[model samples]
Target: MKLHVIVPLCVLFTLTLTQQTPSRDKCVCELTHSEKAFPHDRLSTVEDDASKCNGNITPQKTVELENLLLGLEKRLPQLQQDVSVLEREDDGQLSSVLSLLVVENELLEIKQLINRLNITMLGYQRLTTNTTKELVDLTAEMQELETYDTMQVVKRQNDNRRLRRDLDHCRNGHQPTTQPTEPPHGNCPHGQFQNISGPRVYTAGEYPGSYKYGAWGRDPKPGAGKKSWYWIVFLTSSNKFSNYVRLYSSLSSLIVGVSTPGNVLIHSSNPTTNTVQGPNVVLYGDALYYNCYNRDAVCRFDLSSKAVTTLQLPKGTRFNSKGNFCHLDECYLFTDLDLATDESGVWVIYTTTQDFGNLVLSKVEEPLTLGQTWRTSVYKQGVTNTFMACGVLYATRYVNKVTEEIFYSFDTTTGVEKFNLGISINKMSPNIYALNYSPVDQMLHAYCDSYMVSYKVLFS
Candidate 1:
C-alpha cells in the first residue's frame, strides 16, 4: 500500500531517449502481481473463445456480477434514494441542481444500463436472475451517481459566501499581469486532469505536460523537443486484413503514405456500403477514422480528397461485425467481438450464452452516415481498454502488479471502470504488459513487460 516513485520529467532528457528505468522517486505506487496469476476469469475465457462475439458479457460476467453486487453491499440504499431526491430540490442555487439532476439521471441510467446490456447479450443462455440483477443495479446506480461529485466543494463554498461583496469589488480592480496562462489547449504543463487513479500499473495527472510521448493517442508529427506531435500509429500485429486504415510517424518507425475514406456502412437500408473484413483503424487529428469490417456505417477520409464518403448508423448491429470509434465528439463508439451489441442495454442469449460483446455510441449528420445517438450495452465493454482524463473517461476493468479493479467512470461528465479500482482482482499478480496516458506528461505510463513504470494521480 505504498508506491509513488515518479521522477520521469526530462530526467536528464529521459536518460538520452529510452534505455529503460523511468523512475527517480516520489512515492505512491503499490503494484506487486507476479509468481503467476492473471485470470480475469481466464481473460474472460480467452476473450470469449476468440470472440465471434455471440451474446456478449465476459470480463467474467462483468466481474461476477460486480462481485455479487459488491458482496451485496447494495450501494447504500441507492445512495439514500439519491439523497432523498436531493432533499426535495428548490432550496436555492439549486442545492447543486439536485446533485446535478442525480448526475443527469445517472447518465440516462448509463444509457439504460447500455440498453440492459443489449438484452443481456441477445438473451443468450436465456437471461434471467432478473437480468443479472440489472447489471448489479446499473453499477450501483452509476457509483451512487458519481458520489455526488464530492458535493462540488459544497457548491463552491456556497458561491464563496455569495461572492463576498462581489469579491471585494473585483479585488479593488486588481490588475497586474504579464502573460503566463497558455497551458490548457490540449492542456500540457501536466495540468487539466478530469480525474484519475490506478492502484496498479500506475496512473497520475494534474500538470507536467498532461502526458504526450511516454504514451496517449493522437501524436505523429514533429520530431524531437517538446514532442507536440499529432497522431499516427499502425500496429495490427494481431493480423486480419482488408484496409482498416493506417499511418504513423510520431517521428518514425516508418509506415506513412496517408490516404483517406474507407469503412462506414452498417447494412445501408438506404445508403449501403457494408463490405469490410478485419484489421481496422481510426484516429482524428491527422485524419483517420475506420469502419471497414462488414461496415455497419462510419466513413470519411479526405486527407485531401482521396475520396470516399459513407458514415451513418443509428441502429445497425446484431451483425455488422459489431462496433467502432472508441470515444470522442462526432460520437460513434462501437464494439462487436461478434455480438457485444451496444448503445445501452439489450441482451437475450439464454441458458448462459455469455458470448455477448457489443458497444455502441453514434451520431452522424451528412454523407457521414449513421444518425440518432445514445448507446451503452457493455457486454464486456472493454472498448480498447479505454482511458481519458479531464473531460473524464476511464476504463481499466482489472490491471495487475499488486491489484486493480476499475469498472469504469463517466457521469459527472465521464467515467469508465466497470468494477471500480479498489483492487483485489482475485488476489493480484503484476505483469502490466502495457498502459498509457501522458497528455505530454500527465503521467500514467506503466509497462512492466519491458519495464518503464510510473504514477502520481491525486484527481478529484
Candidate 2:
C-alpha cells in the first residue's frame, strides 16, 4: 500500500511541474518588487508592454520631449542677452524717469509764458489806442490855437522860406546841405503792375515734398558771380525752423538734385538762438534773412562773412505764432514774420497789437536798420501771402484748392489801398508757404508745399 501511494504522489508532482514550466516560459516581463506582479492581461503587444512598464512613455512622446529640449537650448542665448540688458538698464531707470519729468516741467513753463505774453499784449493795445487818440486831439487843438496867433504864422513863413532856400542850394550843388534823406520807395522800374502770368517753373527740387515748410528763390540782388545762383531754406525742425541754407549754382542744379560745394550752416546747432525761425525767408544780395528764433526780430545770415545780424521789430509787434497767416479754414503756424524782397530792397511784413492785427510793412535798411514803416487796413489773418512790387504791397487770399486771389494792394508811395485788384494765382499745391518777387527776373518765387514755383509779373 506504501509503494502505491508514493508512485501516485510522484505522478501528481510531475504533472504540476509540467504545467508551471510552460507558464514561466510564456512570461515576457519581470517586476523587481516581490510583492507586485506584471499585468499580462492588460498588455497585448511589445509596444503596449513598453508603454505599461515604462510609466506610459511612448516613442512619439520621447521624440516630443527631445524637440522641446532642443528648442529651449536654441533660445537660451537670447534669454541670457535679454537678462543682461535688463540688468544694465536698471541702473539708469530712475535717472531716465527724472529727466522726462524735467522736460515736462519745462514745457509747462513755456506754455505759461506764452499765455502771459498774450494777456500783456492785449492790455497794451487798449492803452496805446486811447493814448494815440488823445494825442491826435491835442495836436489838432494846438494847431487851431497856433493858426489864430499872428506871431506863430510869421514864424512858420520864415521857417518855410529858409527850407526853400536850403533846398534850392542843394539842388544847384552850391553848398552841402544838412537835411536827412528819405528812405527809398522802390519805384517801379517797369510799368505799373497789371497781373501775373501762369507758372513759368515748378519743381520739387531734391527733397520732393519731404518738407512742408520752406523757401526757395534766386536772389533779388545777388552778388557778382551769384547772379544765376538759387537758394533754399527748409524748416526741418518741427516744420518751423532751420539752421542752414542750401545753395545751388543754377536753377537746373536745383531741379536736378546736384550738390553744390557745400551748404551754409546758419548755426552749428539747430533751433538755437539766431537761427531761422519761420518759413518766410529771402536771399537778398549776399545774405540770407529770416525770422529770428523765439524773438520778434529779423536775422541776417551773411553768406561771405558767416556773421549774423538781427533787426528787432517794433515794440508791440506780434510774434510766437500769435500772429500768423490764415484763411477761413486754417492758419499757418510760425508765420508771424514774413520777409519779402522787391525792387527796393528787403522788407518785413508783420502785425502789431497797436494796429489791431492789421498788416505792418517796414523797410529793412543796410546795416540792419529799420526804415520807414507803414500800417495797412487789411487784416493780417485774412491774408495768405504778400509780396511787394512797384512800391505796392500785394496780398493774396485763399479762393480754393487750385486758386489764390490777389485781392488787396497798399501803395507805399501814395499811401493808398485798393481792395478789388482781382488778380488770381493758379496753384500747383494746396498752400504757398513763402512768396517773394525777384526784381532781377521780374518773376514771383513761391515755396508751395515743398515745391518751388515761379510766375511772371505782368505789368501795364
Candidate 3:
C-alpha cells in the first residue's frame, strides 16, 4: 500500500517537471551570467535554452509588455474614478492620499520589473533602493548605470554611448553642418545635436537673461556633462563712429556677452571698435571671424591673440554694401557680378541675372586668391533663401508676393528646385537684410524695427 502511494506521487512530480516553462526572467539571468563569463556568440547553450524557452518566454514577454501598456491605459480610467471621489471630498488630506496612491502604484509596478530584471540580465532594467526617481527614468538610465560592475561595464558603456548619440541626434534636428558658403563644391562640416536634460537645466523663465539674450553656444568640453551653460554673445551698436566719413577709421562694433535668463549684458565697460565696419560675426576655434573693410575681407579676432588679423584676398575682391555672405568650411564672398572661382575659392550669386524675377542660387569656385577658377549654378530659385542648419540653405516666398508670413525649405543642393520643408511660419518677410542665425536655438532670427521672427527647422 505504501509503495503504491509513493510511486503515484513520483510519477505526478515527473509530469510537472516535463512541462517546461519559458521564463524570460530566467533566460535573461542565465544569458547575462554567461555573457559575463564568456563571449557572446559562444552562447550556444544559452541559445538552446532560449529556443527551448521560446514557447514560454520570448513571445510571452512581448505579450507581457503589451499587457503592461494596456494596464497603463486602463489605469487612467481608475484615476478618473478616483478624481471623481476627490472632487466630492474637500479634505486636502484625502485628496493627497488618492494622488499618492496613483504614484505608488506606478512605483510598485516599476519595482516588480526591476526585481524581475535583477534576477535575470538586460542590465539597466534593475536599479538599487538608493536610486532616486529621476535616476531610474529611461532618460537618466544611462547615467545611473555608472555603478555597474566590470563584467557589465562594456555593455553599459556601449549602451550609454548609443543613447547619448541618439539623444544628440534628436535634439539637433534640421540644423546644417556649418553655415552655408559658396554652393557648388563648397563644404560645411556637418554637426549632429542631441537632447540632454540635465539636473541643473534652467528653463526659459528660470534662467535670468535667457528670455532677453536669445541664443548661445554650448560647451563641447569633456566632463561638462550637465553643468554647462551656453554663452549668448551679441554686439551692441555704440553709434560712436557711424558717420560715413569714419568708414576708413573706426566703427563701434560692440561685443556683448551675457549669461542666459539674465537681462544684464556683460559689458567690456569701455565699449570697443574695430578699424573697419564689423558686418558679421562667427565663432570658430576660440576665435571670432567677421567681415572688415565693409565686408570685403575676412578678419580673425582671436581671444588669445587679442587683435584682428586681415586675410589677404585675391586682387579685385569686393563686398556688397547691402548684403552679407555666409561661412562654409573654407569661407565665402558674395557680390552682384557673377564671379565664381574654383581657383579663386569664392562663388558669386547674382540676384538679378540668375533669378531674373525669381531667386538665383549659384556657386563660383569661391575665390580665395584669383587664378584660373571656375563658376557654376546651384539653383535658379524663385523664393528668397537664407542659411539655416547644416548649411542647408532654406528658401521662402509669398503666394501672391504680398503676404508677410513666409514658408520655406530646400529641394536640392544647388538652386532652389524643391527644398520645401513643409513648415510655414507667420514671422518673417525678409527685407533681404537682418537675416542672421542665433546658435542658441539654431534659429534664423529676422529682426525688424520692433519685432524679430524665428523659424524652426526639424532635422534629425
Candidate 4:
C-alpha cells in the first residue's frame, strides 16, 4: 500500500511541476532583463530542485516547492510596479540635465553680444576724437587768415591818410614839417598798459583815479562819450534772481556807479516765460548776449531793434539751479555762463558734465547761433572766473577778500595752457561777481556788490 501511494503522489508532483515550467521561465526572463538588482542565485537553486524532484519526490518537498512558487507569483506584480517608478525617475533626471545645458548656452550668447557692443563703442569714440582735432586745426587757420586781413586793411587806411596830409602841405606851399614817425603798429594810443610792479590796494572809500575813477570795463570801442556804453544789472525788489539791466552812457562818470541811475531795459519780457539773468554779459556788435536763467539756453537782445532771440545749449548741460561753480561762502547765482568778447569774436565760457565737467569755450555766431566749441583739459572746479582778451583766456581763483590771482591762461589758437602769469587782483571785495578784460584800454573790469571798478591790467 505505501509503494502504490508514493508512486501516484510522485507522478502527480511531476505533472504539476511540468505544467508550471513555462510560467517560471517567463518570470526568470523578466528578472534577467530588469534594471534593478534581484536574487538570481535563489532562482537557479529552485530550478535545480524542481528538476531533481522529477526522479524522486516526497510530500514534504512537493509542498515546499508549491509554497515557493506561490510566493514568487505574489511578488511579481509589486516588482513590476517598482520598475515603472524607477524608469520615471531616470527620465526626469535626464530632462533636467538637458534644460541646464540650454540655459547655459543662452547666457553665453548674451555675453558675446555685450562684448561686441563694447568693441563698437570703442571704435566710435576713436572716430569722434579724430574729428574734433581736425576741426580745431581748421578753426585756428581761419582765425589767422582773418587777423592778417584786418591788419592789411588798417595799414592801407593809414597810408591813405598820410598821403592826403602830404598833398595838403604841398598846396599850402609849406615844406611838410617832417611828421613824427607814428609808433610801431599804432600799438596802443595810450602806452601799452603798464604791468603792475606791486599790489595796488582799493578800499571802500579809496580807489585809483587814473583808471576812470569807478568804471566796469575799458570801453572796448571807446569813441564819443555816447559811443562808450556801460551796463549794470540790479536784482528787482520783488525777486532777487529776477533782474533788469541799466544802460549807462558813460562808466567814466562817478555819478553813474554810485547811484546806478540809467535807463532800465531788457526785463524778462514775460517773467513767467523766462527770467532774464546777468551772471555775465557781453556787449558785442549790436546785441547784448546773456544766459537765460533756469534753462540751458543763451539769449541775444538786439540793442537797436529791442528784439530777443535764444540759442539752445547742448543736452545734459548744467545750468540755473545746478550749482557747479562756487566761491567762498556762496555760489554766485547765474555764474555758469561766462560771456566774453574779444578781437576774434564773441565767446561763451561754460562748464559741461559731458566733458567731465571741464571748461568749454564756444564761439557765438550771428543770430545767437553756437559755432565751434573747444574743450579745455583744465578741470572747471579749479577756476573761479574766466574772461577773454584778444582771443586769450585768463582764469582766476579766489584767494582772499583782498586778492584774486590769475593762475591759468589758455590760448585758443594753439590749444595751449600756460601758468606763467603771476598777476593778482588786489583789494577787491570778497564777492567779485564778474571779471572782464578789455583789449581797447587794456584794463580789467570787476562788478562786485553793486560797485563797478576798473583796474589797469599790466602786461609784461
Please tell me which predicted candidate would have the highest lDDT against the true structure: 2
> Which residue pairs overlap in candidate 2's backbone?
none
Model 3 poorest ten-residue lDDT run: 245-254
lDDT of 2 by residue, 1-460 (tens): 9999999999999999987774444646875753334434433343353444344322323332332333334334434544555555556678556555544543443344344445545655674576566556555654554554554676789799999999987888965655432222336778777778877666666788799999888788888867768888989989998999999755544644554644999788989999998899899988998999999999999999999999999899999999999999989988999999988889999999999999999999998999999999999999999988767889999999889998888888888788877878988788988998888889999888888788888875
lDDT of 4 by residue, 1-460 (tens): 9999999999999999998876534433443532334345644655565455333433323332332333334334434544454555545677655655544443443344344335545654674576566556555654544454533776698789999998987887765554422112112334422243221212221122212211134335443433445554444432234344456433322221222245446664534334466457766664666777567788877656777788998886778646344665666655778888765567888877778878888988876689988888776666677887656677777778777777676766667776646567763356566777766656566766654545666543
Q: Model 1, 216: alpha-carbon shift in Å?
A: 12
Query: What's the number of clashes in each of the models?
Result: 127, 0, 47, 1
Stronger candidate by TM-score (3 vs 4): 4
Q: Indicate which candidate wins on TM-score.
A: 2
Superposed model 1: Cα runs more than 4 Å off: 1-217, 220-289, 293-354, 358-378, 381-385, 388-418, 422-440, 443-460
Clash number for candidate 1: 127
RMSD to native, candidate 4: 45.7
- Return the candidate ranking by lDDT, descending: 2, 4, 1, 3
Q: What is the lDDT of candidate 3?
A: 0.35
TM-score of each: 0.20, 0.60, 0.32, 0.51
- Model 3, 1-460: lDDT tens digits are 9999999999999988877755556433443353233334434544554454344433224333333343344444545655665566647786778766655554454454344434433432332222334334432543444334456777878899999999999878867676522222123332331111111111221232222212222222212221223222332333111111000000000011112233222123323333323222333333433444343454455544555565543334444433322222211222122221111122223343323323333332222232232222333233333433443334444343223223343323443433333444343222322234433344444322212233332323
| Residue 101 in candidate 1, Cα distance off native in Å | 50
After aligning candidate 3 to the native by TM-score, how far in Å is the CA of 76 from where it should be? 31
Candidate 2 Cα misplacement greater than 4 A, ranges? 1-186
Better of 1 and 3 by lDDT: 1
RMSD from true fold, candidate 2: 41.2
